[model samples]
Target: MAYYISSFISPFGMILINILDGGEEPALKLTTEVLTGHVAVYHGDQIWRVEANPDWSLGETAQALSDLAFEAEIPEELRTLGIAALQNCVSDLYRRQPFVTA
Candidate 1:
């Protein structure tokens, strides 16, 4: 599995992680939109559209993941792994971005 990580540090410090098992740039790019408050998930061999909450909080993100896991019957351990993957991706992205010191 490969992950593309990006971070936008304006208005709010936000991190975006695009997780893909196959070489699907489109899926990775689509995941970027999720940072702007959109939800795209794999469903039945196709990507499904999901409504994102206006408030972008860790809890909100976790809940979204939980919902997806429930719908897809993903194992709890896998769900935790997914969240950890995302968290690691985001943290690395944040670390890479230049820090502004004033």
Candidate 2:
């Protein structure tokens, strides 16, 4: 029953991946691009995609999370954990604002 999030920040934005159950068999995974609002959810052998929304609003990350979760066709049994992962990623991206190196 282990759950964790891994995030990678880039100049463009941040990419977040959520792993469950030590990533063993029957693992659950969700990934999102924070700035782009693009999402992917995995359960068993199938992956579901939530397209990136063109609308951009730094203040609306939570809204974006809901929209992404709503759009994803993730299995009902895995939905809660999957969405939680997405939420964690969004929060991480918001807390660690992107920086530009000169």
lDDT of each: 0.44, 0.53
Please write out the lDDT profile of model 2 over residues 1-102, one tens digit for every residue: 455545443334344445556656446555555554565556678766666554544324344445555666665545676556556655656567654321
Candidate No. with top lDDT: 2
Clashing pairs in 1: none
Per-candidate alpha-carbon RMSD to the true structure = 6.3, 5.4
Write down the worst ten-residue block by lDDT for model 2. Answer: 7-16
Task: Name the candidate that leads on TM-score.
Answer: 2
Compared with the true structure, what per-residue lDDT tens digits does model 1 show for residues 1-102? 444433232223233434444554423322324445655444235554456766665434544644554465444443455556555644554466545221
Deviating ranges (above 4 Å) for candidate 1:
1-15, 20-37, 43-45, 73-81, 90-102
